[model samples]
Target: MDWMPAEKAIEDVRVIAAPEPRASADLEAQLARALSLRWEEVVLSIGRTQMLSTSRTGLSLAQRDRLVRDVSVAILTQIDIFLERKSDRFTFQTLLEELADEERTSVASKVGAAIADVEMEKSGFRFRANARELTFEQFEATQSKNIPDFVYDSGRGDETTPSDVVAVEAKGSLSRLRATKSRLKNLAKKAYEAQVQAFVGSTANDSIAVTGGCAIAFGATPGNGDCTLRLYVSAPAGGTDSGGAGAAVRGPGLGGARIPRSLSSAANAMQQLDKKHEIERESATLDPQANGNGPGHHRPGRKRRRGPNAHGRIAFANYETVFRLCGAANAALMLRQCLDGAVEREDNPVMQAFYQSSSDDRFLFGGTPFAKCWSPSGYFAIYKPAAEAILEALAANRSTPPDSVTLPELPKDLSWEHGAFAAQADGLTWMSMVRGDFTTKIWNLSSGKW
Candidate 1:
């Protein structure tokens, strides 16, 4: 059995920085510095008492800088403790649990404030009241806490001034485990209500005032936490800001925001989500030939499966490695779905060939790796039929296939070539392409076979 090193456990983490105001440029900088604590010595605090303790070690200078940057006291301490305990070598799943623990408090606030500020600056808007003391009663009675995250209006009194306005509450953390659904639900509700309050207060008398939208993010999940960061967003609601709580914004609930931790590490996961939703929604309105089309490509319909044996098992590594090499549609995905359907349905040639061909290095290793199958030519034969079918469908320029033809089934291997198209300089095994059909172009990373 292969052993994974502790450092490789997390691989990397992608955190969305809460947006902060351009005006708070000074405050943000200070806050970032203060939290990063690069300048300050690590001090242990217990309630009102502060003590300098050197016992808590294992923090590298870079690690300390990151702690300062994340502005998370709890996470830093936890990480230090992790190193001290050597818990970093725990299973990947366990590491996520640890991360969740680290992000419960200060990290949340820091992330929230930063996000709020960036959004404000981006839209040339300002928080009506930031961290402004609002007594529970004052917040409720003044109804000032119900504002939407953002607001846009035609004009208040001055016609020359831009009416566009925005408000966003940024939240972040390093916690791996997530708050309970009930708790998160309640938080979302309160936050939404607060957003509405902000919305009304800002729009006040303006008839054209509009609440842009809202967002949320944390290290926790609606999805399995494999250190996969996800985001969710909603379109700005236009029209007059109706008095009372504006319609509550909805989120993906549990499964959404699959952002990897590479680019935009500091961007609020929510912002990434909002941007994605925006793209999807906009694409829905466009014609296939429009300049801005959704992931416009055709594929054969999803194939039905009978059982696991009916479809052959696939090594996850091989799937991923091949996809990287193919540089087209998801190589791994195509393999799994096709194999699953073949096995389940007990298709004679496909299933037999799949099982036979999948032996050797492919089965021994996980996912799609660089290893070749027992029979490359035979494997190609089974794969080619599907590939040709897919090409034919794409060439036909169809979005959804007709009921007559079966859809492409999920690949037997769960691996994907998604990150495989990245620049060679990126130095990662996975390649990533920003725009293109990642599944179709099967460029082999090893032999540079296209």
Candidate 2:
């Protein structure tokens, strides 16, 4: 599989701004199709790699296949279900609230259980496959504990001992909302603090040890109606500052992105409309025609048609732009985390060797892997490099290059298998391949291994 370039990906996103009924319908179909294709591309690509193929992990080929199918179906089903009942005006929070508890559980469990084999209990805390084992939750004998939405306990295989755990807090929000960066940071901090508290409080039980935490924000972008999954890893708490860890791991926000322009323009346009309405009201009140039978009075010239739904159109465009920007930023952050995690873990000797020889440290963002290979970000990150590569190719092909390009940052920390990387990249590439401007060199690694 080859990767789509960034330019083409942006163009695909632009389709969300297309007019009316066709835009909404096309967006939904594209999302489902893209997600399904990406899922298959990931499975097949990883299946051929020696790293995953020969792993001692209990996941067999059949299990992997089933896992992919079940999880993808669950995700698509939930999305479709949400869209079916969505109102003209709804927020990401609204969608989240509307989803039944069972539906939410299905989404969380399918992803958690398949990737790490974690099981959710009726109590809302997740555990490993073993019955006696319980993933660490903030256990309070008197009151409800502030536990994460999902916890994956990598148990030590000894029932008496505590296992390292990964805690995930799931959140949903509108991509166009204000202060998203702060909101996400706060959410991640809260989840991380709860995990630390649970780890400390559960010392008496000796059941689970908190290793890391993740915050997964599922944002619903309005225009194209696509969902953006942003994953943030919580850094370990340092000193007395509870937020230090979160601050360290905070993902990039939509700074100076085109989203702000869209929002500003929309606001300005709305203000102009409001002023026009106010002027009309005043004019009508002062008009001689209102007094009846003024010979010199003539009907006011018809106001230039602004169309029936001009405001609605502008608002939707703004929402779509914000969603697209946030989604891309989220994807970039996830990819950076994956590359950094793979490099830092030193799981692959080849990757480790490359890191040792590399002079640049910017490639590896400092953080511990929350769930290693099973982390959702790792899978998502696989698509980043390829996407960027394709975008680069497209930019180069243009008669006049773009003033700026927004693409995921390439991972510098690890040596990649050409086929594996290409396959992963293809997951995103397929989306933009229709541009007909890309080249095979987009997948080739020149200069260094990574």
Candidate 3:
């Protein structure tokens, strides 16, 4: 017969770990006495049962049986309690219901209310707000991971520059209260990972804070357990448990982009949406400083002329000046409020159309792409000559004598097909045939050849 070593039996096997195991003072006293005795004597008494072994270290048969029974009961009781606590979370079906309702009310309501409030303003601002509800319904539409009770967004106005947004979550108890508290403490570690996977795909914006602080208000219901509500707020810059330091936000870092195995594809789609806007904001910031050659039209602090002919000239230049059209320094400042007093619309289909089509070509006419671009050649094509051509056409339409006009030409060696594809790691490829030319490329290039 196979046998386990006595030492192995004692390995990491503590009898006092459970509360009940240590509950009986009488049993503890007996255990202490047993431990205090010499090992050989105790072993002889329990194992080889001779007169010498029994004389000073023996127990009567009834006493031995009673001790074993009590200890076993304590151990089993403790195990049962642990198991019960572990299985205490809400049912998946119930959780889903709560999450769906919360999203419809809490997050979705906030977005709709904000959009409506902006539209009712009487100012001379021009703002278009796209209030989207990233509900369990939408998540289900993507057929990705179970919907998280959080959301993200981007906003802009004629008076202010575009920026990102993050919202709260109401995930019904994934872990128990004690367990969740512990997990929350360690959530800062996810900040870096969240930044990359959440924001990098959405044109490299902030990891759109999908889940954050929640303000839960408990109701007066009897059988609902202890329904204590809480308002969990996000730390200003301290980040979540799994988040890294602020360094992750400096630029696109490798650590930020690592996708954990636990992530679902649905979350990935949401992230891409965020990236599209980030690219737009970055591209908008690239507009040139001035529009004329007059010496009086120089940038804010640069050397320029104030015509001695009694013409007082003041010029605003660069992104700092242009960005003020949206708002102050706060990126999340509502777009409508920034637009002084103009037309405002919620779910502005016109603006949405612009966003949908222009996001990928943000640098069009600018001389370069944003630093975060994944495609170098494509960036050059749109931001350089393509932009110049469009600007020339606009100039020709607006004025009889165009200031300076130049037409864009396709590179002689590069065909339409060459401009439309991308290759990634693994053999996963993406192709676009929208415009006559068929372009295809792999999605990821790190794994191997495509």
Which candidate gets the maximum lDDT versus the true structure? 2
Candidate 1 per-residue lDDT, tens place, 1-450, comes to 012222212212221222221211111111111011110111111100100011122554335333432333343344344321322221123343344443435544443343333323222221122222111332445533342322211111121233332333444443434443434444544564455323322322222222333333323331243322222223223321223333222122211122222334434544674586356334432112201111322222423221111000111212222222232323333332332232123232121112112222111111232213211100111133333323232223222221111112223342323222111110111211122311322322212122
In the range 60-142, model 3's lDDT, one tens digit per residue, is 53353344334323322322222112112111122323445434233222222222112111111111111122222223344
Candidate 3 weakest ten by summed lDDT: 308-317
Score residue 173 of candidate 1 by CA lDDT.
40
| Candidate 2 residue-pair clash tally | 7
What TM-score do all the candidates reach, one by one? Answer: 0.26, 0.28, 0.18
Better by lDDT, candidate 3 or 2: 2
Question: Which candidate do you rate higher for TM-score, 1 or 2?
Answer: 2
Q: Model 1: runs farther than 4 Å from truth?
A: 1-103, 112-159, 172-186, 195-198, 201-215, 221-450
Put down candidate 2 lDDT per residue, 19-94, tens digits, no spaces. Answer: 1211111111111111122332323222222122122235653454345434444453454344423322211234
Better of 1 and 3 by lDDT: 1
Tell me the deviation in Å of residue 45 in model 3. Answer: 70
